[model samples]
Target: MFICSLFFIYIGEQLDVEKNLKKTAVLVGNAVFYVPSIIKMTTIGGIYLLAILLPSFLAGYRDYTIGTDVLVYGNIWFHNAILSNNFWNYLEWANNSSIGVLYATFNYVVSRFTSNVHIFYFWYSFVETALVLMTLRKNRIDIVLGMSTYYFLFFNLTLNILRQSLAMIVIVWGFNYVTEKKLWKYLLIILIASGFHSTAMIAIIIYPLYWIANNREKLLNVFVLSVCILFIVFSEKLTVLALNIGMLNERYSDYLMNSNIRGGFFAHLLFCLPILILYLTAKNNIGGSRDSQRYNGFRLIVAFTTVLSGFNLKYVYLGRVTQYFDFLFLLAVPYIGNRYYVKIGRYRDTLVTKLLIYIYLITYWIIIYGVQNSGETVPYILNFN
Candidate 1:
């Protein structure tokens, strides 16, 4: 925890280096000794490297006890693949078990050279972190803020739902394809991602979501409402369809099959209320902004999330599918705090709004990591022994 604290501090300091360069120069006048580290920390190359590597180091060297899945599933899967008599047997097992082909193939290939699961974890962490940062970079987003948000929210996802995490990041990176209307390219990427986690195929909706967003603004409202209504009405049919298509997988189906149809409608709506409010407030003002297209695209994702949350009333396990879209809040929160209009929201992009946003994010972080321990990533233990 102390190490993670320092890491965040370092990242936080570097975030405003470009903006505060003059102030930094005045404070450190004639301090030649501090120049190199300061310059390195502020540069794109430097932040990119540090952000990816440091988290990879922390997540990779962690004990299996940190995430429940590490002990219960990831370790077992890794050892089983590596210890198999032959590659064919391993492939047979993976096929029978419904493990994603790409995920299984990754394990098999890595096991060929080294059976050390930590090494496997390190590389996995590196690739996943790199892809996420790369997406932020490609979109010209504030990488430091994006990475910080990811650390607080989705980083633990890499540890718990390894395959789905990989697939999710790939889909995140492919957002550009959707915005560009590159149907084939986007579908190709989705296909590859689906090879990692079948549920990733559900992200194909982003294309149409963006299309709907481009239509009359009121159309988005109507379409989203309709989706929620349709999903609720057909919730059971949809679940059965998902199971039939092998989207839910056997392990999940075994438990969810017997689970009650507890309406989580209010719970999800409450959880998403903040972002939904932010989106509607920012909507009227963003038409003239440079990032308007990006914002609108993301707005559709928000609407989709709303539809999914609404459907959560009938089928609780449908919540799992929402994981792919929930990350929009990490980017949206900062965007609203910084760019949301004063006329509409009355926040004026002031420090007060920023402060409130951070407080909200931090509160969620504490609730997830400290209180609920959703991913079982608490009392952070290193694999030092």
Candidate 2:
């Protein structure tokens, strides 16, 4: 934990707000860094690779952390799953979970081969790490920023919300085809992901929303603002109605109806500040084709998260929904900062603005990594020991 604390500080200092500040690499998820590292594997390059892999290894090795999700949801579920030898039993389990058949089948197949949950966990962690790392490289998200955000927010999720994490990975992977406009391939991928986590189906709407955003930016902003306002006024009522819907999955229903835990105001504020800052600063007349697509993609996600953040203010439990979209901001904020700010604008390059961003990111790191321990891999455990 102490080492992680120092690492966070070092990375914070290393985030050069001024470098590559004018490129789409920030918006499109291309990470800005020392170019020399990319040309050849130097010391910085080695650190980048280590930064990506260390957390994944820790997650894979974790046994039972004192967190609500990992202790019960992951370890116990994997144990219970293996007990059912009959195919029908696995189906029954999947039915109760309201998860996809392939998801259940995957677990059942793994159970047949090994009873140790650690083995299954490592497999999930490794695959998840691969998926996320591939997405970072494929999309060109800065390695440090992407990995930092993943560790800070999404890593704990991979521990507990096993199905949805896999679903997220699938949806992220599907974007490759989505950007290509290969409708059939994208739909198939989404369908496969939904099998693991039904909530993944919501991503199906993203493409259409992208079309709306790219073509109708003004209307889309208005719509998002309206939705946010509406959610604020009638969130409780809407939450009730959503829960009452007969077709809602049992697990989702439980989370909404039964779970009482809600992330506080500070957490919501912290979660949203990065995007809001970048968005307010975003300017046009810059970036390339890659930048345009990535910008639109993140802008669309930011709009949804902005609305959901409002919903979270009222229906606190609705906060969970933000995870689906918030991950993109890791790229969006950096993109917006580099693309729009630091152009010697009246306010952007001023000492105060530069200092403020560094201070904010630094403070955020302290809270998220040092204090909150949200990733729940602190004092990282090695399973073999």
lDDT of each: 0.67, 0.59
Top TM-score prediction, candidate number: 1
Model 2 lDDT tens row, 1-385: 3246327434433543333333222222675543432333333344444554555556666767623556645665667678777888777877675656766776677788888776676677667766765675576544444455555556655665677778877787677676677878988988888888766665665566555555657877677656544553464465457668755554564564322222444665676766565555556435687668767767766766665665565566555555556555545554554455443546444233334445566566567545766555444556654
- Alpha-carbon runs more than 4 Å astray in model 1: 1-29, 32-47, 85-89, 217-249, 255-267, 283-290, 341-347, 350-352
Q: Which candidate leads in lDDT?
A: 1
| Candidate 1 displacement at residue 23 in angstroms | 19
Write the residue-wise lDDT of candidate 1 on 1-385 in tens digits.
3245336545544654554443333234655332444564455365456656788888778998876567766788889877886887887788667678788888888888888888778788888888877786676665555666677667765677788889988888887888788999999999999888876866776677677766677867587657644654454566678778876555756533331211245545644666666667643434463477667767667767876776676666666667667755556555665555434255454355456555655666676566756666777888944
Model 1, residue 264: what's the lDDT?
45
Cα displacement (angstroms), candidate 2, residue 256, comes to: 2.5
RMSD of each: 4.7, 7.8
Error of 1 at 306 (Å): 3.1
